[model samples]
Target: MEDIVFLYRLVPGHVHHSYGLHCALLAGVPDEIIKRAEVVLDAVSKNNCVERLCNENISAQDDEYKNAMEKLLTFDIDSGDLNLFFEEIFSSS
Candidate 1:
C-alpha cells in the first residue's frame, strides 16, 4: 500500500514564497549572478556565512559592496516556517 499525501493549490497572494533565483534563471539574469544568488540562498538557508565567500567574486568594492552585503544578509528566504540566522558581519556603519 502507498501512503497518500495532500497538496493544496497556491492561491494568488495567499502564499509568500521567493523563487527569485528560479525566475532570474528564466529571465536571463546571467550565469554569474545566478550562481551568486544560489550561494546567497544557501547561506541564508544554512544561517552560517564566511567572509571569504562574499569577498571573492564580487566585482565592486565601495558602496555596492556595502549595500549588497546588507541586502544579502537581511533577505528572509525561510518562508515563515523557519527561524533566520543572525551573526556579526563586516560593516563600518
Candidate 2:
C-alpha cells in the first residue's frame, strides 16, 4: 500500500490503508460514520480481529443502505465509456 497511490481529486496523491474510507468521504458519508470507519481501519491494520470485526460492524448497517451500496458498486463502465464521459466533461471546460 505504501508503494501505491490513488490519482485524482486529492492533491499530490497520498497512500491510504483504506481507499473505501476515501470513497465514503467523497460520497458524503456522515462524519461520525467516517470516524468509526477510521477506528475499524486502525484496528484491522494492526492485525486485530479483522474479519470478525468487519463483519460485526458492517452487519449492523441497515438493509436499505446495504442494498443502495450494492447497487452503487455494480457500476460497469468500460474504458471507452470512461473516455467518452471524460471527453464530455472536459470538452465544455
Candidate 3:
C-alpha cells in the first residue's frame, strides 16, 4: 500500500488516475503478487519518463524516438483479473 501511494504521487496530471487506485487495491493482495505488480508499474513509469525525456531531446521522427516508443507500447501488465481479486478481498473482510 505504501508503495502504491508513493507511486501515485509520481503520476502526472495527464495520466488516468484509475491506475493509482488500481495499485492501491492491488496492495491488499499477497506480498509476492504485490511485488510483481510493483515491478511492472515501476517499469511502466520509468518507460514513460524516458519517453518524455526523449520527446524533449530528440526529433519525433528519429529512429531512437520510434524505438523508445515501440518499447513502451510492448509493455504488458497482465496481472490477471484484478477486479476479481479485489472482490475476493472485500468479501472476505
Ranking the candidates on lDDT from highest down gives 2, 1, 3
- What lDDT score belongs to each candidate, Candidate 1 first? 0.60, 0.63, 0.53
Model 1: per-residue Cα lDDT at residue 69: 76
Model 2 segments more than 4 A misplaced: 1-16, 50-93
Clashing pairs in 2: none
What's the true lDDT of residue 37 in model 2? 83
Better candidate by lDDT, 2 or 3: 2
lDDT for model 3, on a 0 to 1 scale?
0.53
> Distance (Å) between predicted and true CA of 74, model 1?
30
Report the Cα lDDT for candidate 1. 0.60
Candidate 1 lDDT by residue in tens digits, 1-93: 674444567666533456667777777899987987778777666777834544533445656567757766777776522222223334432
Ranking by TM-score: 1, 2, 3
Every candidate's CA RMSD:
16.2, 13.5, 17.8
Which candidate leads in TM-score?
1
Q: What is the per-residue lDDT of model 3 for residues 1-93, given as tens digits with 9 covering 90 to 100?
A: 244244445554556334654555555666755655666667676674322333533563475556655644654448556566546444543
Cα lDDT tens digits for candidate 2, 1-93: 254456656557544544788788877999988988888788766768644445645665555466555544664565346566545444543
Candidate 1 lDDT score at position 26: 72
Judged by lDDT, which candidate is best?
2
